[model samples]
Target: MEPEYWDKNPFKATAKAFPPGFHYRPTTLNKTRKFYEFILVDTNSVSIKHFKDPKDPNLNTHSTIQILKVMQPRHYGSNLNQPKKFSAPFDPTRYTYWDYIDAWTNVFWHQNNKYKHSWLIYFKNNTTYNFPNWFLQWWNYFGPIPQIYPEEVQQGFNQFSRMFNNQESRIPADLMYFSSFALSWIFSWQYRYGKIENKFDNSKAALDQVKNWFQVHPEFLKPADPETSLFLNKKSQLAIFLAGSKSKEILAKNLKEVLHLLQQQEEEEKPSKKKVESSDENDDQDDDPFYQNEDDCFGISLEED
Candidate 1:
């Protein structure tokens, strides 16, 4: 369904044939060969209609998009079977959001076009839920999902956080995923487009901002699973510390302390590092601390005992 904000925009449709539930335009890459359609199903998901023939919009495949994670732009291309990998020279820089329920649902569009398509519907279903294990594992190993735009995520979350702040009140379970998905959408097209594409530095800067937000609202990281919630908090903190140590500028007050703590950790784990180093030169992937046992990893011990 179209968001209420569409009625206030200039591209708001006036034609009688145009329904409120459908997008004003198609969102696919090939306008001639394909006719892709989108409709906002709910706050946390969208219904997709993929038409192979431009002449036959009615004859199409149906799918649903439930956003799981959002980050730099990447696509599976025309051959949908291939895995998505970020290649150089990313065109039309924007946050590419991944779907939890469906893989083929991934797409990128100009913010205005997305606005026309009503990418998000402002509806909250007062239900509670938890994230899938695979979803958590994928992001954790790859890299922590940086909050490039905390304000936007916070704004989207405020709708629920504010209402649920009262005693005995609570946010819907589904909103937790929505809050995570909201982080991906909050980005600057102009800044990202104009600046040199330094993914590491920009991501670190954005994540540094997240530390402030986390301090203000630790509940944002609290999922249903206590272990999972703790893991997420630790993962984010570890990612920030790792990013800060490699950077030239001081990110936050705690960063230096965290770096010193990391030094102590390195010193304590010198023997283990030596073993890992001597294991095999071919075992490059093993360098990632995320793959280590979570229970005993330095990541889990970032916070003071």
Candidate 2:
């Protein structure tokens, strides 16, 4: 079936295809969409709280991203496989998202590309308003499946984010994923965001002004603001607190831990990527060098613009 424009974007998450985040007709995308996809979910589906500091009076000091947390039943994946140490391992093959659905969902869902493919169809049956646990089960309890290549996921996601920025609505997670899928198509096949070909030998457009395009475009809002979410009530703000200050120290400590884990995932994914390039005969291999490199076409130094 021909996909609708409002559905998937070339750069959307899981653009090319993800081998069903939730498998089985019962659990996979056939049933749930939200938990695998969106942020600021139905409040009841997942519990959310702003980090509080009883030690200090300022309960309101956190990065715009700090307030997110997803809740789940305690016993979901503890019986057989343990949850991977990292909450959101970029290498999904090594990690299971289900150990704690909300935690994992927030990591993937918070970004725009959650469930990038599902939006392509009119999914009236299986759905999720928030993140899904069944998707996480494989990573958490059964041990990792063949992980999706991070380079590919990254490319799909960046394009997904760009496409989500292009949308005018609250950006449900699935839609965020789809828009980038659409954009990824543009990045690879179309050159222009549709079917038209690129006239230049290499169609590299500078990314320095890409965010500027977001600034101008209503559909794509800065990840920083309330404008981007139906959920994040507290608007995004820039703050430079004293480095030695107690509150700043705590936030820094927690965020640093999260970033460190993400760093390790980055490293592991990095090594596999080199092998992917050098090898010539793998059957499951992908076509583009990787989605991330495309950013060079769009990416100017963040310092510049």
**Model 2: ten consecutive residues of lowest lDDT:** 115-124
Kindly report which residue stretches of model 1 are placed more than 4 angstroms away from their true locations once superposed: 1-44, 47-105, 109-125, 129-184, 187-305
Q: Model 1 over residues 223-293: C-alpha lDDT tens digits?
A: 44676866677778778666755445555655677778868977998998788787865365466665555
For all predictions, the C-alpha RMSD in Å is 23.5, 26.4
The TM-score obtained by model 1 is: 0.21
lDDT of each: 0.37, 0.35
Give the Å shift of residue 163 in candidate 2: 45
Best by lDDT: 1
Candidate 1 has which clashing residue pairs, if any? 1-40, 127-173, 128-173, 129-173
* Cα lDDT of model 2 by residue, 1-305, tens digit: 23542335534433434334322122343223333333223322333333334565444222122212334334235443553443342323222334234333332222122211111011111122222345434224312111321334344445445545444554343333422222212111121122222431111222433334344554456454554563343222212322334786687785676567657877988978888766743532445566536656674666843
Q: How much does candidate 2 score in TM-score?
A: 0.16
User: What clash count does candidate 1 reach?
Assistant: 4
- What lDDT score goes with residue 226 in model 2? 54
* TM-scores, all models, native as reference: 0.21, 0.16
Among these predictions, the greatest TM-score belongs to 1
RMSD of 1: 23.5
